[model samples]
Target: MDKNLIALIKILVKKSYITRTDLEVETNCSKRQITYRLEKINDLVEAKKLPPIEYGNQKEIIIKTETKNFLIEILRKSYNDKFYYFDKRERIIYLYIMLFMNLEYLSLQHFMSSLKVSRSTILNDLKDLKQELAKENIKISNSRSKGYYISGPELDIRGYMMKLVLLSLEDDHNSVVFDSIIDDYHLESFQFSKKTITELANKYKIHFVGDRLDEFIYIFIFLKARLKNHKNLTEEYLGKPNLDIISEMKEYKFTGELLSYYKDTTGFSEQEFHYITAWILAVSVGNFAEETEDKPIISEIVDRIMIRFEVLSGTHYNEGPEIFKQLYSHIRPAYYRLLFRLPIYNPLYPKIKEEYSELFLLVKETMKPLEGLFDGEIPEEEIAYLTMHFASIYSKKRDYEEVVKKNALVVCSNGIGLSAILYNELKEMFTDLNFYLPIDAVKFKDFDKPVDIIFTTEYQLHLIEQNIPIIKINPIINPRERYEIIRQVYTLLDLSVFKQPSLESIMEIIWKYATISNPTQLYSELLSFFSSSFKLKNEKKEKGYRLIDLISEDCMNLGIDAKDWEEAIRISGNSLVRKNKVTQDYVEKVVENLSPYFVITPLVALPHTRPEFGALSYSIGITVLNRPVEFGNNEKPVKYIFFLSSLDNKKHLPAMSDLLHLLNQKSFFEMLDGTKDKKAVLEYIRCYTSQSTISSSTME
Candidate 1:
């Protein structure tokens, strides 16, 4: 008995006996070959004292499914060996003929058309097919008068094609070649699902070799079509946070309001969003979880989704229709969240249409028309304030609470020295606190003031009231204890926004380090100027006014140094002076993209740069405004200038905080508008800087 005969019998049993036509379609074996193989199979079974495979009245072959599966399993193992000898193309052609056996009325023209070949080619291929079949004891009964037919015992071929498809996926070269051929023509001319199988193979990165490429391509295409229509889908909660992949953000108790808010802000549909936004929020803290290190988990999840999709479609993995649908459903939403949270903006919003509405609206506001100029989206990414606005907003939400901060006033017996120390320390401990200190010592009756709390030592009790929230401590307080007192005051006042700085004295240390040039001259002159010129403006005494307006005139004078400074002091931004300083590390990247300092707008240029570049001088250059100039984008202008020149980024850190304190004053910008003389500008800065309510952008 021939090997082909044995193979046919095995396929029949393996598939529980498929139709003869279906067998040929799957195996590409000719009817003549199938018949010959069946004859040999019968002889072999009789010789072995085994029952022969049967054929039903319907003319379908019969084989035990279990036995066929076992044969296929063995054949698969053999296919792996390079030395395994079989003519794969010849096998397919042979099976094709067998599956359509005994159709004598189907002439040579019909056969040629069905096979998608020329008459001569078909004749020649048929000759080879017949010869192969003869070897297996099968015969094609044909005459010039009768055309052609086949006679044989049953032969099953479903298992043969199933095995072929599996083999094709295992060896990728075959699938690639098959895909190329199948894509060129519609195979209804050949009657097969070309795309379905090919798509599945591609998704799995499966490759094929030899002649099976066309079949694989057909399978893949079919799978793709089905995927597009959402014909098959299933879902499961895989769990929160696929730590294996950085792209997979951890799952949160996602609220619809949050989703709706996000949609309103970004314009992406809820179904299109992912948890990556949340992931970014987590990563910004600069620490990562141990589980996040695993990469294989991502690949595994992708695989599971792929396989599950196939199961739902009731098709072989590669041959299932709807492969693309599955792919989109499984990965795109997660990708959206990841990119939204990542450094790159590509892939998340590949186009303007994809951008969120809030982001777009914010950009529009930042680019609002100047007093005399029209506003529009600038093509330059750097010029845009979209990133800055969101960063600031995000920072506030993460670091500050919305609750109103508590106000505290510190009175001391040592006058300016103790008051300054307490004020600085408390501000460092509670950024949200509104702290104040009197310029001179006063009796307790004179110090009868309105304040949420009061902090003073035993010696200063003569100047402070016991009825107030008095936090009594040593005159020379521990820095840590002082911070705790501020914190306690904040708690008592129910201030949510009063978050302490990451480190106490951070700004102070930075200022000291940066103010290295002529510290004595700078400090002495600055202090003397403050004491003699500007008298304190009481916020409580000012009627129908914001706290900022009360101190604005004097604060502006101090900020704008006029008589001594040679050059006009302009705007100030972040900077870095020391290369080796760990504290100054944050300023490094900011300066890389932007001009270290920008002083290039009209009369109103903010003469400051990014802090990464060290400052050349350690001095404040103030220019008294003879006239106001629109300094910031046209909407915000400058009247008096306090040009900051730090030796390095670290030194200017204090001024940054100080500026924040000033800018956050509800009327700080408006107050600058009211300054009339150079003296007023200097007076305002000195008076405002001394007191705790630094109403600047930095403080906020």
Candidate 2:
């Protein structure tokens, strides 16, 4: 049978309905080639005395239940034979599995014999493998006497193995081939059977999803293999601390029982037991075996997190009991995951990081207290989930009516050129503000029908006498003046508005306007109008909040003289304190908590503490050093320091997301290096934020 036909059959069996186009794309073949492969697959199915799959009207290849099952079984039994003539990608996968699973040295001849390929072909595959492994910091160490073997940091190797296993699970087409290799090598052997582990888990009432059971099984099997080969993880590698708290818990007892099964076979050490304890804690087990007495402990932690989040974001979720309950439930499970160093796989990890970066960071900071309990840092995956919980409560508590749009009057003593520039700049900075065209400062007194605030080139006594807030700004609107204007506007404005009208309101309006003779037409028009209006409002709001809107020239330092990371951090943080964004104590607290410094990138560092550590507002201070400074061992050297002082964790997330996006760009450092003037750098940032805001709005 043709290899393409075999691959196509494998796909159709796994998927209920796959488009012909998808098949063409995956196979890198033309539609005509797909048709030929499909015909071959149908012929094979007929020969095997099985019902054939057919292409539906929509050009989706549909496989019946029986046909899929039969094909899966047949493929499983004969996978090795069909795997002989493999493509380049398939060949690489096989090599990956061999290197990952093999305990001893592998020679060029060994691969040649196993693959039944020429020496040059095997050598080329090794070369490709070497390149791929290098990307992950894993290298194939070739010894003239000992043979070829894989070597790298243990963590990196295990991470790559986990990724490979996950890929195999996801790609069902290659799973059979991978399984065959596992079985042939007797690599599936475990000290404790899957049944024994499952029974123990159920006996203790541990809550793990079905898929996670496979993870547990494979983990134990791998552990057994490592023990047999005397490849023990060091005490430092198994850095789980103080399992005494859960010593009396049912889950702990269950883990003990599970370990007992492997004690005789593997000679499990205390370190090994501690390692298993971490895994047990990290897995999604519910309620600490229903210890209702411990509920307060979890609730207390949740309360602290919520309070810190509220302070950082300048928002409150204290009034919501549902929020507390939800957080309490999540934190209990998360506590174990953190304690065990088990990182869950969140599919929304990237999106969450992009959209709610500040909130995510806040959650990470809030959970720092728990790190002492776990004796390790909480993984980003767990932090992402916690961010979602807090975000949910924040969104629910947010009052749309509180975000009222404000009207402003701009007064300029200078010519129309300065006034027009100021008007446009203010409009861009304050998205929620509606500004009247610039009027002469002399006309300021005559104009007032009661505007929320007045922006003038000079503070006027008459405007102040009217009891309206008067903000003084330079006519040219430099970065510092712009930041002050924004701060003043935010302080003066109500910052809340009524929620947008609902569909029901639109329907009622349509009913009121319609003649009753054309109900369908009226409904259509009303729906279109409401949708377009809603879309416009959302776009305007999104484009209004630029990243540069949160930054000011006063808080930005281009050439800071710092001998060490501490000095650099202090310099960056003190800028925020001077601006009253945070207090001196906040800076001190940040420095004190600098043991495990948050190195954002090789060139950048973000040093921050909890919002309640004396942060007065949501602000970020940037400091670029004259030269790079070393933080400590295991930390990257830093030049750019972003000191974040958030009033509330939620509000500054969009700005944080924008910053991350900017930092990810290759030219970000280049642009920073090219400028020492605060205004020039601010302009570059402003332009970037403006472009990003527009692009995101368009995408939405």
Candidate 3:
């Protein structure tokens, strides 16, 4: 059997069914040669006693699975340059088969039509493909109803490509184009006209030759552009071939010998030969297509191809090499027809053989299409924009906060009192400036906004449950430590700064705030000092206990309800007032990546915030639960909640040490869980305060 015939069969088997017409278009050969080749194919098949791969009913001829493996082995040998060198068509045919091995059913007539060829040419090639299959005991059959497909045991197809397809070009091509002859392969090709070409040449103020000079260069440019963008150009039929003859252009010259050499080297048909030679002339001169308008599109193509390949797939000159070749194969003829109308460059400079050679190699590498090759079809401008966008994203290392900033809303009560102060503070702090009101003057319904942060001095119980950052402060006559509050807000929002502080400084602050030894423990007491509700009437008349009575009476006077009080307790008691309280190991685990807190005191735990986080209020929430829960100190589980808070670089040492002394009592903790009365809790606190040694120490 003819080795080429065998190679063709393998291609068909792997590909399932490739139309004979495709072969004709690809080989640039006639129907007679293909048919004669097929008759020779059957004799070889008989000599080997292999089952016939060709079986045609009424509709079409098909290549089957059994024959496919045999053919692939032949391709493997050819691909390795072990046997004869294959032509461009054969190479494309083999690559297509190897690349899309799972292709089963194929429409023979439709495939032939796509190749723009006659039925006889297709039949002859199918004959050759089948004969080769027969030699390998593979069967190729066609049914009037079911069309074409392979049938047999599974074969290790992909493994074959991994071994053969990925083999180095040095091992196969040997740095020469015609060293391999792949006649059996069928690849799509197209062309353009001279009139369009000269138009482009005139517009660009370059030389335009009616000969093979300018045509070759134009094709090269088009191929390079299309390949980079991963775009396919279908032939646009414009009634007649738009041919323009530029008689004045004596700038570039070409010899018949050069044309003959090209024709002999690259197996181009008569028309294609003319087109290729003309394109080469265009390329010879420096009139390559360099449209600024096309740059964005080309760059976009490069970016997209890179992302798809997960590598730098193309260069800036054009999309890349692979796209060029595919275009060369399919659109060369269409290009010829459009050439007359195509605006071209003049005096096709001497062709740069080296440049073309480099381009050819790149095309070969890029031809192996993968899944993500063309998934994102971005506009040229958008792709250019994305370059800057992706750069910013990477430079800033923005994970999710950037998104929140663009969408979040900030709020503070009517821009006057503490709420206003907090509002301006946050507005200056957060880079993405957004906020809302904290006053009852605006209805709760009116407060509906995409709020992410809400800072308020006066607690409006109705607004507590709203979706936003609710930074509540004690209602005060005059808000001190406004700067401190602003700084804390900045840290919380992770504000963008003119000059970013060192990572050490940031981490130090974070660790100090997240740790149990900081001043966040005093939030409530700090709030109490600033709050002006102590002189209220109705609630103090009932409670008897001075502080609680005063607060309750003020709330009743303000028309707040019991439900509001319960909510206040939940929000203030456990959530806000309790500092970096490590209630459990899990809570400690959550903050472990940021800071190491609980190791300061063995039996005592002081929960607090770092001084940098503006502690506007010094408050404490003592939750002496019914049962003592295990805390950092294994020797004595925590019963006291010392909610500490502080201003920058200033820790209230005496108050902290006083609270620590109370917690140092064994009996106080022993009966801590037993007490249920509110009065009893207060009485315990009073007793603790009466003790001596009220100073703080920094010595660990």
Candidate 4:
């Protein structure tokens, strides 16, 4: 039999259904080859009088539960006492598991025999394994008498082992390999079950999701195994100062109660208790009991952070008590993690950093004061979680406001069955639009809701006379149809689409006035000009607004002489004060709060304080230095400075967001560097801000 067929039989015995894609990955076979092999396996199964395997409705391979055990037994017998061949990566994993799980010294002959490989091959694998372990600060120690074993700080070893276990759980193929390791080592079954953990959680009123509960159980099992092996995670392994927050958590009591189950069985230590408490702190995912004594401090700190966040981002979070409660819940666990120096992994960190760059920075800055409470800095991973919380609230608020502003009516033939489905689909797709109850085609004329557009399954010729744009869509919309409908909706509502200037209109004046040596180069430049100019032309300008209105020539300084970042900040802030936009005290406050963390990105610094800090009006001041000045960290030196002052926290948000967006653009910085004239810089700012607003609004 093919090795791929054997692998498939193993996976099928373990799971009722496995995806064809997963089978393809495991067997390294094409889809057609998998089908052919499944047929051959079924032929063999029938010969043994077992049920035939087939694909279920979801296109996953299915085998009856009664037949799975027989199939597994037959496959094991067919192995004929041959050891499975492991690839290089698999060899490393096998070695790590052996060293990590084995309490007794492992002999070189043991690995060679178990792997069915020669001694030199095993030695080469061990050499590669040692290099891999060194990256994690783990070492493989050898003694002539005791053979080889892994030696590391117990916490690091546990962390690495946990990662390996998690990897196994995520990949079915890896789980199969991991099971073999468990069998080889004769590892004990998990001491604590899910029911016991759930019961303990309920008794203490600690809420954990199903996945978190699984994680806690795994952690408990690992801790028990380590204790049974007489390997303890010491206080020095944790290396964190004693925090009052850990003691205050109700999870501390829950941890003590849960571990009492293993106390007489495996024995426990103070370090073991703290280790379990830290795991609980890290894994618990829901709100804690509301009656805790530290609620006041949590609430106070949340309030202060939100206020500072509002001032820094110029956006208000006014969801009231619910927002406060949610933030408080997240902050509590986060506080424990920071206090104990435990790391929380956020898989979405990269995407969050890329998409919500401004909000991420704002959350990081707002967290500075809270960090002082623990006398340590919060990692970016923790801040990303906070960013998600705030960003979620902000998105909901924006969608709510937009829904109130725009309404749409759906018309269908039956107006009940398919209409309801279509209405729900459209509502989910266009969250900013409020969708009303569907109306039958016959009653469409009588329905009135002052809607912005009419979406119908069938074309309505009469609705054309009513001056309302009618969009025709299929009752069951596919992806392409849905996209077409959305594009039509936006086009009809004049949100995303705008008229572009004609090429002739743009080139007429330039061609009439200037002589061109190369028409190709001239046309390229003209096309670029028309693109930028027309984008600005189509932008909806706010009343009483212009770039010069925010930052005047008097407040703009070029080649400013400054000794350091502090002086640089003061010079720009003094410009704002001189223009009567802010007070001198605001400059001092801004300078005092300057930190390397506040560097928005490379080569730019935005220094500002709360709106209440002596601001006369909402304004910005710009300063460009001839040379870079070292900020808090020399790694990110500053040459461009923006001093912001706002009369109201929320009013300056648009400008601040626009400024940040502009800074992200390479061309904007190129223009700033190439020119020292204030007017040219102001024009670039004006055009970029206007274009950004239009683009942002259109996206909504």
| TM-score of decoy 3 | 0.17
Cα displacement (Å) at residue 591, model 1:
16
lDDT of 3 by residue, 579-639 (tens): 4422323223222322113212333333443333334443444443333335532334433
Q: Which lDDT tens digits does candidate 1 get at residues 1-700?
A: 2335445644553332245544554568766666666666556455655556665211446544343344444344443433333343633443333333223354677665554556777677667766755654445566676676543421212112223443444332133323322332332322243343344335533333222344333332332232233322222112334323433433221222223321123443222223323322322211112233332443343344334321211112332234333332223332322323211111112221122222322233232222112122232231122222222222211234345356677654322323443455454455555665533333445555567876653222122224355564433233334443544564557666555442223434545568556533543444344322222232121111122222222223333332311122312222112222212222333223222122222233324332334444433333445445443333334444544443332223334434434544656555556555645555566677567542222111
TM-score of 4: 0.55
Instruction: Evaluate candidate 3 by giving its C-alpha RMSD to the native, one decimal.
Output: 33.7
How well does candidate 3 score on lDDT at residue 338?
25
Show model 3 residue runs off by greater than 4 Å. 1-7, 19-22, 55-58, 79-700
Best by lDDT: 4
lDDT of 2 by residue, 621-644 (tens): 889888998885655788888778
TM-scores of all predicted structures: 0.21, 0.53, 0.17, 0.55
* Superposition TM-score, candidate 1 onto the true structure: 0.21
> Which candidate do you rate higher for TM-score, 2 or 4?
4
Model 1 CA lDDT for position 513: 66
